[model samples]
Structures are given as C-alpha cells and as structure tokens.
Target: MPILIVEDDNFYAQRLKEVLMDFGLEATLVNSTQEALSSNIPLYAAAIIDIMLPNDPDITGISLRESRAGYLSGVALARRFRQKVPNFPIILFSGYFGSFEGESWARDNGILFFSKEDGPGALKYCLQKIGIIREVKPRVFIVHGHDEHALIELKDYIQNTLNWQKPIVLRDEPSSGRTIVEKFEDFASSVDYVFVLMTPDDIVRNVKEDDKRRSRQNVIFELGFFYGQFGRKSGRVIVLHKGPIELPSDIQGIIWIDISKGIKESSGDIRRELKI
Candidate 1:
C-alpha cells in the first residue's frame, strides 16, 4: 500500500518520499488540503500531514477563513479524513517549534505528532508504530572482511539454525550501475539489523617492525555507518570478532561478541538476543 504525504514544500516532500522508497515502500504526495481531502483515504496505509499549507482558495466545503489560516489546514484535513476512516493512522508533522498546542490536540485525537527537526528517524518510528512497516522476519545485513568461508558459515547458521530470514551478504565489489557507497546504503536501509564480522584480514607493521592483524578498512567503515544510522543504544547492531583485533577506541561502550570460543557456541547468545 502507498503512504499519503501532504506537504506544500516540494523539496521536503521529495525527501520524505525517498526515505519511504529506501524502506521498500511507496508514497503519494499532495500539495494542498483540498487534494488530500479529495483523495481515496482507504487506499493509503498511512498519512503524513504537514502543519503549514497554503490556502486552498477553491475548496468548496471548507470555509475560506479556515483554509486561509494555513496553520490549521493539516489538522482540518486530518479531522475530515477521520470522519471517513476513524481509526486510520495519521501523523502530523511540522518543522516549527511552537506546535505544542497542535501536538496536544493530535494526541487527544489519536493521531501522532512529529517534528521534522527530529529528522527522518521520527518518520521511521511512526511508520513502524502504525504497522506500515512490519517486522515480519527480521533481515540482518552481515558485513564481513576477507573471511569468505566464515561469513558463509555465519549466514548459514543464521538462516538454517537460528531460523531467521536470509541475511544480506553483499559482493566485495559494486555492480556496474551504482557506486559501492550507493549500493551499501540501499541494502543497509532495507534491513532491520546489522551483524559486523571483524576478522584478522589486514596486517599492519608497527614502528618496531611488529606486525598486528586487523579487520579490513571497509568492515570498519560499515560498522561506523550502521552505528551512526541506528544509534548505539538501538541494540539492532552486533559486532562479532574471531581473534584479538584492534577496535576503535570510540566504540568501547558498544556490545561485542567474542567468537574465539567458536561461531556455533556463540550463535545461541545472538539468537536469544535477536529473539529468533
């Protein structure tokens, strides 16, 4: 089902649309309250309405004074929509800070209120809450470095033993159409969880000529990207390492599973944590 987005700003509406697409969802954009009110409300999975909108001068049923106010146009449209679909999920969003009154009213009316300043994270949270985004079989994106055999084993255990869906295992090189970063972002955004395997792939020599084993640079980059995208406290991220690998000092507080005991032995802990 497509999501309905009502926003007068073309750029912001397009940005929200991109975010929805990233989640493998579709969206329909409307610029005015009149357009939203006339749409087929039952067709949308959910509605995202912007607080400020231009006056719909030609709207017949709504009063001109009310339409011209702009600030309450979204609220008015939402109320009208509720008349048709009383229990539909509606999210009211505004970048403006002085929206506590509207937010309170929305809460009283069983609608969600989000601030654009909170970024696309707020939109994602609302979508999940309204059942637009389903956590059916949680997909995990596995990022590994130079440990092809170990990576395949982990993927098999996650899918067959743990009974989780097939984990996303990307090729080392990007395909023809897109850059590596673009492909990574597209794949990462679609998954609900991340598993990073830090193996002793790269060897670096110190000033004293002592060599130390570490994970590949790409693996470390992916770990940081996922951490930043889903906050450290999200618990959606897990780092699994084989040996004594050098980790970034900044990620000291994050959880890391030591696989030195064996991947099979450590699999139970991961399965339990993921509720699989």
Candidate 2:
C-alpha cells in the first residue's frame, strides 16, 4: 500500500518520496492539510505529516491556531485521522520542530515523531519500528588516505560485486560553498556503514624513535567519527588497511581486514561482516 505524505515543501516531500522508494515503498504526496483530509486515507498503509504548513483554501480566512493551518497543522491532521480510524498509523516528520515540539502529545496520542535533522536513516528506522519497511540496503561511506588505487578497488568491489549504490568518497564531491565539517556531516549522517582505509600515507616520528609509516591524521579522525557514530559492536564500521602501516591502538574489538593482497582477497571477509 502507498504511504501518505503531507508536506508543503516540495523539495522535502520529493526527498521523502525518494527515501521511501529506496526501500521499495510507494508514497502519495499532498501539499496541504485540505488535500490530505480529502485523500483516500484507507488507501494508504501509513501517513507522514509535516508539523508546519501554509494555510490552504479550506482554512484561508480562519486564524492559524483555530483552523489548524500553520505550525501544528500536522497535529490537527493526526487528530482527524484518529477520529476517522481509531488506530491508524501516523508519523509526524519535521525539520523545524525539535524533540520538545509536541513530542509528548504525539507519544500520548500514539503518533511517531522524527526530526529531519536526524536524516533519512532515522526515518527509515522509524518505519522499521512500525513494520512498514523491512529491508535495508546499507548506505556505504568510504574514508581513505592517499591510496587512490586502494580506494578505487574497494569502491569497485562495493558497487560491482555487492551491487550497492556507489560508495561515497568525500574528496570527489563538490564543496558547494559549505564548510568542510558541514559537507562531511551532510553525507556522513546518511550512511549506515563506513570503510576506513588505513594506508601508509604519512610518516610520523616519536620523541626518540625513527619515523614510522601511518595513516593520515584526517583518516584517523574520520575513523573515530564513524566509530563514535555506530559503535564498535554495531559492525557498521569496516577498516581496510594496506602495507605495514601503524594501526591505532585506541580502536579495539572491530574487524580489521588487510587488503595488502588486494581487495579481491578480502571480499569474503567483507561479505561476511556485512551479511550479504
């Protein structure tokens, strides 16, 4: 069954539709509360309503609060849906509204709330909670040192072999006037899996010891970032190292695949860890 999406922002609504499509789900988008009320509610498996919406013809002259046209329009819509179907599934998805915004009311009324800032993964996770979406194609992010060859091989294995979407490489993406951290988070927040390549890209010297080959500082930073995001036991972060590079002792209890013999040799390990 199709899912109902009530959102005024066309861009955001299209994005939500795409996210649903990725999981082989269909969506019916309605821009206003009026249209949503008129939609065939029984045709949809569930409904995702935006918290803020503009006033429509049905409530044009009425006050925003009284007519339920603005900020809490989704709340009003959810009430109406519940009135029609006592146990209809409804989710309130919003970018402007935080956890404190009508969250308590939603919980008390049997409605799920998700913040867009948490990214599409969180929305899908919510869907999984409600038993709407069951399958998940792991979104892959690649963090690598200066080893372009290793990056290409691993990307090829992920795309061609695993048949997953092209793994995201930060360096290849456009900056688009955003800060490095902003750009990183824009991509990183969407991915569930990470592949950090610890290549011998840098040489570091200790207080009284000779210089030893190690992964770049940026690579290590990204590794830690993803590790913190997914945790060690989540099995979402994969570390691929080449050569006799000095590995970080701080990271423990995670699978480390050696690609010294090329990415092909470690395909079995990768597949086993990813369970595909």
Candidate 3:
C-alpha cells in the first residue's frame, strides 16, 4: 500500500515523497485536509500529515483560523482515520516549532510528531521503527590501495553483477581534522560487509634483505579492522587479490579470491557468498 502524505507545500511534499521512494516506498500526496479526509485511508499503509495545511471550504464545522493556528486539522484527520482504521500508523510534522500542545495531542493519540528542522532522516528513522518502511540497503566498503583500475573494476562488478549499490571507496587524501584510520573506521561502521582489494602496491625489505611485494599498509590495517568488527568466521569480510601477495599469519585460514582467475568468476563467488 502507498503511504499518504498530507502537506500544503508542494516542494516539501515532493521532497518527502522522494525520501520515501529512496526507502522503496510508494507515496500519495494531497495538499488539503479535505482531500486527505476524503482519500481512501484503507489504501494507505501509513499517513504522514503536516500540521499546517491550507484551509478548505469542503471541511465544514471546523474554525479554520483556530484549527490552522493550533494545527488541529491534522489531529482531527488522525482521529477520523482512527475511527475508520484504528491503530493505523500516523506521523504528524510541522515546520512551525513551539507546538507543545499539538505534540501532546499527537502523543496521546499514538501519532508521531517531528519538526521540519529535524529533517527527513529523523522521520525516516521513525518510519523504520514503526515498520512502515524497510531499512536502508546494505553497503559494502571497498578497501583498496594505489590500484585505481582494479578498484573501479571490482566496484563495477559489485554494482552490476552482485546488484549491490555503489560500494564505499575512501579518498586517496584524508580530510582535514580526521586521520586516515579514523575515516576508515567511520566508514566501516556504516557498512554490513567489507571488500578488500589486495593489489601489489608496495614493496618491503624482508629480514633476509630480499624484496617482498605486498598490499599497502593502509589496506592491511583496514582489512584487519573490519575482521575485528565482523569476525573472520562471520563471512562479512572478503579479500580479492590481483596477484601473489604476502598475508599475515593470523589470517592464514581466511579465504581470498584470486581476481586473476577472471572478474566474472570471482564476482560470482563473492555474490553467492553475499547471498545477493
């Protein structure tokens, strides 16, 4: 069922609709309380009512000046909706702050109240809590070093082959006031899975003075960090190597996909493991 959005402001209403669409929800927009009251409430999964709405002549027996000032029109609509479909999810929002009375009424009537200044993310969270919309899509963090070509290919595979949205790719240069490690940790926390591209980017001197090729220290650090967050056995972390590279002894048993085999085959394996 589509969500019903009652707002007088066309721009704000369209913005709210777009936000809901981002969460994979369908929404119906109406500008007036009269239209909202006349709408088929049962067809809507939920209602997002703006506190202030344009006065409509069809809405009789209500003082528009007092009702609009107090934002009682939305409350009356909610009550009417309850009479029709009890326990229906209703969210009341307003751009005008300082509506303690309106908020109290909404709380008493089991409706959520949010200020426009709180932004759509706050409203989205409330909708998620009430089970009106699904949670945001799972994200995969792509950890790479100097191999931009391989990183791009792997990102494309995740988006095209695995049907996942854009993977997280950190900037080459760190932003001001935040260390590289801090940025990686912040990004990792938001993602459900991490994909490490262990391309041969750095060479190090071994104990015997022989040159050893390896992925960048940053890549290794991020891989270990995600492993610590998700655990090795959880299968939420994946490593793909372009060529032979040295790995720590602690990660000996962890599986690593060889992209040298072919991007198609390697992406397929990763996709299956991700269940996408």
Best by lDDT: 2
lDDT of 2 at 222: 93
Q: Write one digit per residue (lDDT tens) for candidate 2, span 119-200.
A: 7876875687578987465668999989999999999988888887889999888989999999998899888689999999
True lDDT of residue 15, candidate 3: 93
TM-score of each: 0.57, 0.57, 0.49
Worst 10 residues of 3 by lDDT: 55-64
In candidate 2, where is summed lDDT lowest over 10 consecutive residues?
60-69
The 10 consecutive residues of candidate 1 with the worst lDDT sum are: 60-69
Tens-digit lDDT string for candidate 3 (98-175): 565677788776677776755564576569656886756557789889987788788788788767768888884355
Per the 3 Å backbone cut-off, how many clashing residue pairs does candidate 2 have? Answer: 0
lDDT of every predicted structure (CA atoms): 0.80, 0.81, 0.76
Error of 1 at 165 (Å): 2.4
Go through the candidates in order and give the C-alpha RMSD of each one to the true structure.
7.9, 8.7, 13.0
